[model samples]
Target: MEFWKNCWNCGHDTPQERVALEFFPRIVEMFSKKEDGKVNQRVWAVFYDSYSFTKCKKCSAPSLFVDEYWTQTTSPEEAKCIAEEVKINGVSKSGNLVHSHIYPGFLKEPFPQWTHDLEETYMVLFWEVYQAAALGLNSLAMMGIRAIIDKFALDKIGDIGGFAKKLNTLLNAKIINADQHALLEVVVDAGNASAHRGYKPDNNHVKICLQIIEQLIGIEKFGDVINEIRQATPKRT
Candidate 1:
């Protein structure tokens, strides 16, 4: 079986070919609720959980995957189509992907790879938080964003009181401008809400929060390199 996915090792979406003996319907539990609302009633509702061991065509890295497929959710015609698809292409073309557990897991999209060159802790934490956001763990991702900022502040300028003070200090020292400070304030507050108030942000909201952090991390990591480039440029005078 072959399917497309973003390869963690290659950092790109590529075709993956599962081993010929790779797939199996490992478990099927009573998934749907009965009309009678009884504990042990049988209905037309069933779901399949399957596993696949595949190799990334682009990078040749092996990955193990568990995919949850709700078969009864689709119409009979669609089911027929899926069956035909499986016959023709050797892949299931229908079903909602409730979860994808790809071993040596993957980021949904490529993030700032240059961040790996920064402090090891921040580098590791940033990727973890990024993956959390990708996995729709908005609350956890928000808390992680806050923690990264806090760690960055402490590493740059010690434990200088609270968020407000640290943000101001960064702005004053030109590490971040007024506009960037305002954005950072939003990120921090979102994190606070998620951490302390049990806030679960919508996907769009989480995306904006993550984007702001991406910019902040880019600046934090590449700012010095950028300054060097500016200095080396010939003067117009």
Candidate 2:
């Protein structure tokens, strides 16, 4: 069967075609003898456990493969088929896999009102960063991070020369503190290096950028929430 799965190498949610490498099934039979010396036969549940390797068919720059398997069961003839079923789950990658599917910082909820009000363009770029990182495209992911920063600056300060100036303006206006400003400078530089210098950063680099971006977003959109939480939290004696 053909299905879609996220490629760990290419960082793309590509189509995969499964070729059944091995399949093993277990079946049980029960028999009983009647008082009249006649035999009755019945079949219980038929269990199936299968393993297969699928190669992503959607990418051209060498295919990424995943090993997947399923464990399921079908009731006997009378009970009907497909008593329980679960599709293949990705277990391991084919190569030097350093990335995992879990990115806790990935934004799933709607943007906080202030962020949306600031610039809705950032919302789309934020998602693109998540998507690019998910598919293992760190370069593209960094670019998305850069785009988000640019969008935010443009919305807040309008056209002010380049990204560096816009960031300076935000800093001067105290929209972001010194620490936040420094961290964003790293993100902007990393993204710029990727775009202009053809630098493909590692996963850890991209991860730090994603986290900083999340923090910036939280601060920009939900500053009130942060303030309320701080006030509600009790200090140690």
Candidate 3:
């Protein structure tokens, strides 16, 4: 008269009343009509099964039940209209037709821990952006100095001290003008401070790095370049 099942993980014999069912769809259909262009959509069902038993063999925890059941379809014209609405409004008036069934108190059981983990992940991502910005500026300064030395007959400087001295020599000799030389000095100092020492940078440092990179490259192009480097860095969270 009644069917019985066992828990897949725990192997406890489950009662018919304890068994749970859940259903999801592989594809959702969207449609629009030939006559008026109204839209509608429906979920195309995909079957999945889950169940709970009366008790577990190892822990003897009482089996909990969870499942979902539903079936529906939409015509082509109606589906198109629904798609357009989503594009314009960002959310469907009726929630997505696909339904979920879960054990009682599933959110209360699992979500708090999930939320904390997600928050930690986000914070890590935020801190990584700042770190990337610092590293990118240092790289930019090294490249800029190498380029200048190659193009102009500027002497190769061995270390930070030597590089600063050579750069100052070029400035004093009027090979490079005041503003450009001053900018180069600022970039060298900023990069060295960030790379060698542990300087807690402020907003001013970020702004200056952005400006110096733009001056070395074109403003429009460098903005995208800086952004790409920043984005490529792994986020902390």
TM-score of every prediction relative to native: 0.59, 0.50, 0.27
Model 3 misplaced stretches (Cα beyond 4 Å):
1-131, 134-161, 217-237
Residue lDDT tens for model 1, 72-167: 554556555544554445456575446567677566467676876878888888888888887888899889989988987887788989899999
Q: CA lDDT of 158 in candidate 2? A: 91
- Residue-level lDDT of model 3, residues 172-227, one tens digit each, is 77766788777777766655665566444565665565455334433223556699
Q: Count the backbone clashes (under 3 Å) in each candidate.
A: 0, 2, 23
* Greater-lDDT candidate between 1 and 2: 1
RMSD of 2: 20.9
Candidate 2 TM-score, C-alpha based:
0.50
Report residue 220 deviation for candidate 2 (angstroms).
Answer: 2.4
Against the true structure, whose lDDT is highest? 1
Candidates sorted on TM-score, descending: 1, 2, 3
Which prediction has the highest TM-score against the true structure? 1
